[model samples]
Target: MRTKQIANRFREVILDGLWIANTNYKDQLSNITWEQATTRVESLNTIALLTFHINYYIEGVLNVLKGGALEIRDKYSFDAPKITSEEDWKILLNSLLDNAEEFASLIDTMPDEQLDNYFVDEKYGTYQRNIEAMIEHSYYHLGQITLIKKMLSNE
Candidate 1:
């Protein structure tokens, strides 16, 4: 697997919009008010919850890439702190965007040999697989956010 190719895909999915869709997390979550973000839509996760949930893995893997231990716990994935105002929501979005850029940069610098190596353990599959998973995970939640935003707008 070519690391740059994989990294490019990661950037496209995380920050830049991919060819498969015209919007990415950056575009989808922009200028969202706290009311729209925290508003519940049926049984689906709130936009805030889903946004934080998607970044949970990215932040975890990013920590590992930065030489920290993996600190992710599935139980706390959706436990984003209370967002009482727009400032709180923007803070979360900014953190997500910052991490996305840093994570993509880390992936771009990964040596080809490292890409094939297992991430943390064999159970988690290769680094390539893990990075791709982050991309897929982001896209999946991006769709959810888009839908939730549309619903909040009564569209």
Candidate 2:
């Protein structure tokens, strides 16, 4: 597949699960209240923290795609802002969606040669690998969010 085609496919599955069986972030995370978002289940990260952590890579890579240096630190990925109200949660979710859209657009414009080249440094792997990894990462956390929601609902 071409570069744009690959990027488009990634975006569809990552953002909305367009052609995938699992629920996307939009569907899974929508309608979440502050209570649900901030509730902790055992030792697992709260849904709010998981949500931000999932988007952290997207925001970092999006910056790199826009010619900025990456500034992500794994230790801080889960440090989402405190959800004091519904508006706070809404703002965070909106930012996540906005960044995802920008990242998708940037990927679509990337040269095919870039996809084959190493992303940032050779130790990190190729652009294609890193991009796909982000998709996998999001889905992984989205699953956690889904299960957490279900667990909370059952309580």
Candidate 3:
């Protein structure tokens, strides 16, 4: 039950369905062009950068969920690959969406009891803490992406 709720929240942020913000990553990013995604707004990070940043943690946590190591680092989270063309942008977006789905799916199948277990190490807190943090973090960047899109459109 708890796991399902957490997974659903994850899905609601990245994939289909909307409960908190009324918009998901797929919906918000579907019509965004490569040019717009890569466009800069003052010192703000580009939409593409935010997208990559969000997925960085998702993929890292995802690996841990799949019985792998916690290999992501904060310093390298924004080291997004260059988006040189529409194909490049599409590839990045697709990867994010794909990983997001997989991440949520893994969480959905997670045993509720596992949520209490420490993730990677004690310093990182429990699986539930990290998962919830991902959801919140995604939402934070999602808002930035939406605002960046609007700023780009207005320019």
Local distance difference test, per candidate? 0.86, 0.82, 0.92
For every candidate, C-alpha RMSD to the true structure in Å: 1.3, 1.5, 0.7
Per-residue CA lDDT of model 1 for 64-147, tens digit only, reads 999898889999898899989999999888888899899988888888899889898899999989988888887788888888
Worst 10 residues of 2 by lDDT: 13-22
lDDT of model 3 at residue 35?
Answer: 91
Q: TM-score of the candidate numbered 3? A: 0.98
Which digits, one per residue and each the tens of the lDDT, describe model 2 over residues 1-155? 46787677667655766566456787777888977899999998888898888788888988888988879988888778789899988988888888888888888888888999988889999989899888777767877888999999998
Q: In model 3, which regions exceed 4 Å deviation?
A: none
Please report, as a residue range, the 10-residue window in candidate 1 with the lowest summed lDDT.
13-22
TM-score ranking, high to low: 3, 1, 2
Candidate number that wins on TM-score, 2 or 3? 3
Clashing pairs in 3: none
TM-score of 2: 0.92
| Alpha carbon RMSD to native, model 1 | 1.3
* TM-score to native of every candidate shown: 0.95, 0.92, 0.98
Collision pairs in model 1: none
